[model samples]
Target: MIELKSPGEIERMAVTGQFVGGLLGELSGVAAVGVNLMDLEHHARRRIKERGAESCYWDYAPSFGNGPFRHVLCLSVNDAVLHGLPHDYVLRDGDLLSIDMAVGIDGWVADSAVSVVVGTADPADLKLIEATEVALEAGIEAGRPGNRLGDISAAIGAVARRYGYKVNGEFGGHGLGRTMHEAPHIYNDGRPGRGMKLEPGLTIAIEPWFCATTDKIKFDNDGWTIRSADGSRTAHSEHTIAITETGPRVLTRRPEPGEGAASQIKQAAANS
Candidate 1:
């Protein structure tokens, strides 16, 4: 079910989102060459515990995913777009890594993901990463009230298609609130004005993932770690947002570009 949040509930979710936001920032800072994917998972588990929060991914078992993710965060590296199970993998120069994380605070869940180059970043890698960021931004720009979910999906698709990449529909963004995943599966491509209509308190995740080559994907033998079928590079970026009376509110906003607290959220207004 798609749950609409009360103003008070939105406030609680924002608090939870802020923690997720902070953790992504910390992880990006510490992720370097030679860093093991499992090490990041260890830190994520410990840090969430220190904050008195529970990890939504640790016990997550969605229909398409393997039983219980067994880790607090997903460490998806180059060619691996989503659900990358952490293992004894070591970082390498010019490798792109996408870290997807989620946590639950008082039963409310927030999900977010970030992609970055491991070390000695390559120009092509940098471009793909930037494209994902731009796609995510476009998706966010399309999340305003009075709009349909397709607007956001189209926005993201435009960016990926512009860069000559096809989307993997096998997995995409979804409604997020009391649970990590919820109603109204948001695809990477769709017709505008189609699907669900945006409404106040409607919270959802807008994640845009891209593969350098074809859209085909293959899950690793490990049962997770979705990678590009052709072994091309990949990048992912995402954010959870809420529809408000006036506009859209990005719950998982990070500190940047002079975005002030409470005011960082663009296209938003007082809830009705």
Candidate 2:
């Protein structure tokens, strides 16, 4: 069921969100070429532990999972999309990596994702990352008090289409709260002002992920990691947001307080 949060609940969520947002920034500080994905996972776990927050991804098993996920982070590198399991893989120069994390603080869950190019990146690799960021921003802009869920989807889809990237069919954003995944799936494509309305105290995850080529995907043998069907590279960006009386509040926002639309747009242009 879709349940709304009370004012006190919203305040608690914001607190969890601040920690989650700060964690993403901290991870980015250590994210670079030559860093092992496992090492990054350890860093995240250490930070979350220090804050007395729990890593929700660890030991998490849903209906499709063959077993409990034994890791603390979702490390999707290059062609990998969502649910990328972190192993012993070491990031290299020009590699585009997406790090997704969620934490339960005081029984509230906040999730966020970011796509960063490790080192000196080639032109095409840079373009892919830029497109994902642009698309994510468009989606975020569409999220407001009067807009419908479809408006957000259409905005995100338009950005992806502008760059010739195709949206993967299976995975999209979802509602988030005490549990990781909730109701009302947010698609990458939909009609504006249709479906659900943006209401106060309703938290949702806005994620925009696209493959460089085809829309199809295949799951890794590990039954967790998802990659492009044609082996093409991918990029993903997401933020947990709550609908409010004023506008949408980003829970898992970027670290730098100045990292808003203006700064992000400039970064996207420079990368482009």
Candidate 3:
């Protein structure tokens, strides 16, 4: 069943989301060239422990995933798109990386992801990353009460198509609450005005991931990493949003106090 949060519960979710957003913002600042992928995982572990929270990815064992993910971070580098398992690999200049994380705080869960290039980014890479970020914002804008879930999907897909990127089929976003994943599967592409109706108190993760070439993907030997079939680079952007009587409220927004969109946009550009 699709779960809805009370106003009180939504406040609790926001608290959980603050930690999630803050972590991503901090991690992105240090995801530069020469950093080891394992170091990022350790950073995530320390942060989660320091906040008295638990990692949703570390013990996640979905049927589609390998048993017990065992890593605190999904460190997708270059062609690797999703569910990337951290290893002894060290990042190089110009490598595109995506970090997906989920944490449970005080019984609430918030999940988010961000993509960035290590150093000396390619123009194409920067564009691809920008497209996914724009798509995420578009999807969130369509996630207000009275709209259907498809509206959000359509908004996301439209941005991808506009950039000539193909949407991935296997995974997108999902409802989030006490658990990491929940009901109401949010597709990357769909017809607007269809699917579940968006109502107040509903919270869902809006993620848009796209490949530069084909939509097909293959699993890495680790049994967790997913890469593009044509070896094309991909980008992913995600945010947890709440459907309010007023509008959509982004629970996982990254900008700190006194920071504006210009700064956030600059952060995205710098990552590229």
| Best prediction by lDDT | 3
Each prediction's TM-score against the native?
A: 0.91, 0.91, 0.93
lDDT of each: 0.84, 0.82, 0.88
Instruction: Compute the lDDT for candidate 2.
Output: 0.82
Give the lDDT ranking, best first: 3, 1, 2
Those runs of model 3 whose alpha carbons end farther than 4 Å from true positions after fitting are 256-272
What TM-score would candidate 1 get against the native?
A: 0.91
Model 2 error, position 66 (Å): 2.9
Alpha-carbon RMSD to native, per candidate = 7.8, 6.4, 4.9
**For residues 1-272, could you state the per-residue lDDT of candidate 1 as single tens digits?**
77788888888899999999887876776677777777777777777998899998877776676577788988998999898988888789888999999898998889999998987998888888898899998888888888999998898889888987788787889998898889989998777888788889899999989888788999887777899999999999989888888787888986532333223121121220
Clashing pairs in 1: none
